[model samples]
Target: MEFYTKPGDYDPINYVPHQASHGTKELWKTFWLLLGITILDFIIYFVMPASGLRNVIFIFFGIVKAYYIVGAFMHLKHEKINLALIILVPTVFIVGLVMGLLYEGNAISLMK
Candidate 1:
């Protein structure tokens, strides 16, 4: 609200900032990214193969999607390399555990 100068005049010094830009570009970008991931997921789900190629392709796409989400969308690009690696420490351990389990699984089947 503006202040009255002399009960008959109003002060014009008071003003409000301009409203933010009007656009939906960012929203559309996010929507498209999500739609793309959804389509990839559907494709991965219905297609089945007995060879290890399927697993390799699945893992490749999974890593790509993860990198995009974490590196670009998460705004982690400005972070230091050490910081990023610190966050990835858990992934390293998880991958190691998965490898160990796969080895054990194969060994057990062989023993049987």
Candidate 2:
């Protein structure tokens, strides 16, 4: 069929939208925060004896880092609440499922 109406109509193939460049301040902040969390994770991993508590601490740190990464890098922080919830709610359930599986698996091993 016919796509363009007139001589100078908008061309779909050669459309170039102008995107404003957001500065690097927020990116630098996110970088530093992620780096700090990584350093903390390493320190805790080395200093703490292997135990359930240590595992929980690592999980908590992981969630925190994931949140920051999604918020800053993925631009979820600027999105609507409903959109954010749509992505986060399933993640919460999955993490719960994993924790439950770990607990049950450990219990089963103890019985063997």
Candidate 3:
């Protein structure tokens, strides 16, 4: 059996597809937005005293950052709705489960 039938056959081992350059505008925007969010998080961390509200604020910011990172950098925003939902629905449920667990644990600790 011959591995390659012809002289100029396709080589699976040495395949590098050509990719066009997409503009960096969207990337720069994502960078700036992430930076602003980080700065805001830092300011809020120092300005607010340690409390439930402060923690909630931090969580909110974290979720926002995660959403932006996934949507922009991961290219999920441009994906079809079904594909995005497939990746995101379980994530939402998992986050909800974690928050619920935290709330229940805090309540149980208070009762102890």
Q: lDDT of each model, Cα atoms only?
A: 0.70, 0.87, 0.85
Listed in order, each prediction's TM-score against the native is 0.58, 0.72, 0.73
Sort by lDDT, top down from the best: 2, 3, 1
Distance from true position, residue 32, model 2, in Å? 0.8
**What is the per-residue lDDT of model 2 for residues 1-112, given as tens digits with 9 covering 90 to 100?**
3456586887888766554567889989999999999999999999999998998899899889988899988888877899999988888788789889989999999999
- Please list all clashing residue pairs in model 3, or write none if there are none: none
Candidate 1 TM-score, true structure as reference = 0.58
Candidate 2 displacement at residue 109 in angstroms: 1.1
Residue 32 lDDT, candidate 3, scale 0-100: 94
In the range 55-104, model 3's lDDT, one tens digit per residue, is: 89988988898988998898788778999999998877887898899899
Q: What is the RMSD of candidate 3?
A: 6.2
Please report, as a residue range, the 10-residue window in candidate 3 with the lowest summed lDDT: 13-22
TM-score of 2: 0.72
Q: Candidate 3: which stretches are off by over 4 Å? A: 1-21
Query: Which lDDT tens digits does candidate 1 get at residues 1-112?
Result: 4445484574355544334443666546755776787688678767765458877877877777777677656645546789888898778899889999999999999999
Clashing pairs in 2: none
